[model samples]
Target: GKVIEGTLSVHAKGFGFVLVKKGTDIFIPLEHMLNAMDGDYVSVEIVKKVPKKNPEGRIVKILTLQNKEIIGVFKSSKEGGSVIPSDERYNNPIIIPKDSLSSPKIGRKPKNGEFVVIMRTGWNENDHTVTGKIIDILGKPESKEMDLLLVARNNDLTIPFPTQVNKALTGLPEFDLQKELKSREDFRSVPCFTIDPESAKDFDDAISLVQLDNGRFELGVHIADVSHYVREGSAIDKEAYERGTSVYFVNNVIPMLPERLSNDLCSLKPNTDRLAFSVIMEIDSRGIVQKYRIRETVIRSAVRFTYEEVEAIIKGKKHSHAKTIHLMQMLSLILRRSREEMGSIDFDISEAAISLDEQGVPYSIRPRERIESNRLVEEFMLVANRIVASHIAKKSTKRNPKPFVYRVHEKPDKESIQSFLDLLERLGLKYQLDKEVKSDDYRKILDIIENLDYKYFIEKVALRSMTKAYYSTKNEGHFGLAFDAYTHFTSPIRRYPDLVVHRLLKYYASKEKDKKGAMKGEAATLSKKLDSICTHCSEREIRATQAEREFIKIKSMEFLSSKVGETYGGIISGMASFGMFVELSHYVIEGLVHVSELKDDHYDFDKEEFTLTGRKTGKVYRMGDSVTIKIKSVSKEEKRADFLLV
Candidate 1:
């Protein structure tokens, strides 16, 4: 029998009813419910269906448990302690085991107010409650930062790498690193340079270009050869694979590889010999790649240029190195042409990079934008990666295709795109929504919004209407980059997928041409496993993105904490019955302006028009409307920013 699927509705009393599929709701008796709580997906067995009565069903099994890890404030009665979960959906206070509780490490235990991470152990249906054990005390609930706790709890992240994994990394034998460099091609004579952000520690990729005798350019994309340092099946390799990607929190970075490899040996520091997997691309002035080669190379970087420095060079700043400046100019022009020809979506999204002082207090909130130097590195990497992917895909020796992990981006959902189209139509923007939206279409939209005085709100809405790119075994190509095949062959130090691709590329290079056909079976098996890893990596990417957003939100609130009652010009980003979200002009920090504070007339939200309209007055608060707002309050503990209508 097919078990009915529905959400469970529990009450403050000791019982709840399961709303079964389209039929009458079933009564899950308090005792018969076992450990099932509200909002749990339970596989229920239909016990009885009587006439004119609600169906009675017994829980056969628990399909899924909501809220795997709970974050809450700890409170202790004389008998024991319990956690009041942060989410109101699970209002039940979970009892904490006494043995699992310990006194606080830093100070006298927060007897009745410390925050902690609790894992649900069991639930008592008779009491309509959940029982959990305090795994670890996070911090004081009133601490300046509560966002990290929320991030860890929401993602069920565990601190401290496994002991065995740590021991493996510590006990690994040091390879003959110096001797291994002898076999690689030496690029010490070339004027290789690294372009990165000023705050960056992990330098992964470097570029060097020279005009060839045949009027073509030889562009070298040298990546940090992480595979050369971290041996296969080693502890470091296993740990890197498990992490999949680095986690970037507000003030810190939990890297994929250990510091010894990622920040030291694998880092392509200037004026030092470093191992690299090099891609030599022969491209014409017309931005066409004529031929390319991949090789094991050793390079000494001559210079390290920040994005700011590169941007200066592009703007014809009188730099000492004339040749490098000219190359930068040529590269930018080439990239612009390539981007347009490929219909690549050139978007301008501001990333909030907070500046912090020594004691971890927020100093300032800065918005970083992509400059010409950023595009210089981006274009070279794209050319390098495309050459690698195309080269690998073109080989026809094997029965089954060679397995390489690719960064794939699927097309956006039609319904979501249509919604954005409808929004544009309402805005009176002449965008062709009925036709397929390509990179060119995106470029045109960006241009349209850029020229308009109210471009900020339009771009914000446009951003909300797209899909995120992720890793996959099957290359659907990258829609954003407009590449038929794309793979992450650079930045192996930070990204795990790139490391995997580097290892695969090296393995292919090591094999004899005659034996390539025989390697298909093993490659196929790895491809299947790589696919699973891609999904896991993609999910982790989402988690990382959310964590980054949460950190930014916290920093944004802190930045405005000092400016309470200060009024600033803001644009409405979102609107709801409760309040409207207003993004400040200078800082771009969005805070809620509660509806209760809005005087003059009662405003009702119109869902169809996506606006809050005053019934009595004709004033409207639409998505892109600008308004004056005063910072009312900033709550670091609550992770919220509140504003008042001026």
Candidate 2:
């Protein structure tokens, strides 16, 4: 028997899978598990290996528990109390004795049916019972606030700012704004403005444009100087690093930094002199950068325009900066075309914009419209990220090198790419890839399928084929944006990596001016520090993204609860061994249509084509297939919906 160790992911049903480093996951039946829960790291011994089937393994050891603390709804009984896990994937309840509640951390006994968190304690394997101590009592699950709180707790997101961080903020010393202004470059004279979402408060970036005498355009991208206020290794910085990135849950946001810094001091509020790291570039009409300057500067934005307002301006509306915005639009188009020509893969994906009322009830959920204004801001940020990455890369030659964090997107694997191409060819669209798949090849395939009814399906498949972009000390380049170098340098208010990038730039700037000595060996130390930070921050980023998506899914489930049994037009968005996922046409929501619901005929799953063929009726259900489905059930607790094909 061979033993392998990996994290265990338990299904809602009792069985689980051990996700190893490579290949198919090892299947662990319920009886074989040693009461190991979901997210637990465990060692398994391979018992059987059959061809064309996943290797079967029995859990030999429970190395460590993934979730030390669990979130659940408390139930008080005469004997004691038991907390039912909120995720439901855990499928186990923790019992808490009445004595454990005498001096609970929350200072009171949790009411029956109240949401709470508990620390794991000893357990009995014979009775399949586990014990825990109540630590915190979250609100009742029926409460309006519980919608978001439940999602946050389930995702392991700690929302409240630590008291130590707040105390450190109060003890922060003040600096003279005027004195600091004299020491940095001044960009206050530029006619700059911030364009963000209508509800945005933390304006971290601003845009300014000027026409140069050499028949070139001067584009200025200014970002908030968050690192200037939150000193490194301070309590505030430590807390921000722990949070890593902000979690935007509909209207509620869990900011990485406290509001005092993210919303006030570090925010680039309009009509105020704020410290900034600005990148000014001189470019020709075709969007080729002739020259660029990166500096620390003081800027005063004249106004803050929302994307909607700018969209109106683009459509011939009148504003003081209407002409400037129009100019920005022209420049964005050129830059977009230039980048695409250089093989940038622009997956024209639309993001869902869920609108909720004051009570956290969703009134509408639809894809956000792509407009010229959105493209304008995107082009500027992409250019700035690329230019900053290029600047840092050049400073590090072979002999005299510097350590920096780069956002790298590696080339897609050939197997995944072949699957994507096969799907396109099956749909009657023919496209070819070079010896090595070029970014533009995917872009060209997208263009061919642009007007197809199943374009979204094809686009998603292609996107999945590509590797996820991440931070690294080594430069693998950005395949999506077609950039030789790229980094996140635009939003320091919400992202920790951006703040670190700002610090690195400032350090280089100071070193260049002072020509200083005795900062030797700092590069080596900083390199190690940055490499570890990149891995931690990347993990935190994925957590934040999952929490955000889960919140939306939870809310969507709530919205569909009353519509049970109602029929809606849907598209088959995904396929799995158990069921097919259906995307409801009316709303930005998807639900599962389990195979058991297909009672009309015995169905055979076509693994290669990702389709379910009805043996008697000759009906095939597949990705992008349109069908009418009735909502069967909605489990708000589990954040899942069940659909039946009508």
Considering every candidate listed, which one attains the maximal lDDT?
A: 2
Q: Report the C-alpha lDDT of model 1 over 252-309, residue by residue, as the tens digit.
A: 7768887777777788999988889999888888888888889989899988888898
> Model 2 over residues 1-646: C-alpha lDDT tens digits?
8999999988888899999987779999989877778887888999999799899999877777665778898899987899988866667678888887635347888898899888777656466466778888887877778888877877778888889998887875545678887787889999899999988989999999988888799999999988889889999999999999999988989999998888888788889989998999998998999899998889999999899999999999999888888899999999999999998888866566888887778778877788788889999999999999999998886655678989999998879888888877777777867699888887888887888899888888888899999888887799988899999999999989999999999888888888864444787788899999999888998998888888888888888998998999988989987889999867869999999999998788887888999889998888988889999999988889999999
Native-to-model Cα distance after best TM-score fit, residue 218 in candidate 2, in Å:
0.8
Best by TM-score: 2
Please give the lDDT score for candidate 2.
0.87
Which sections of candidate 1 miss by over 4 Å? 1-67, 76-82, 87-100, 103-112, 120-132, 141-150, 170-182, 312-322, 396-400, 433-435, 512-515, 518-520
Worst 10-residue stretch by lDDT in candidate 2? 121-130
Q: What is the lDDT of residue 255 in candidate 2?
A: 92
lDDT of each: 0.77, 0.87
State in Å the error of residue 17, model 1: 11
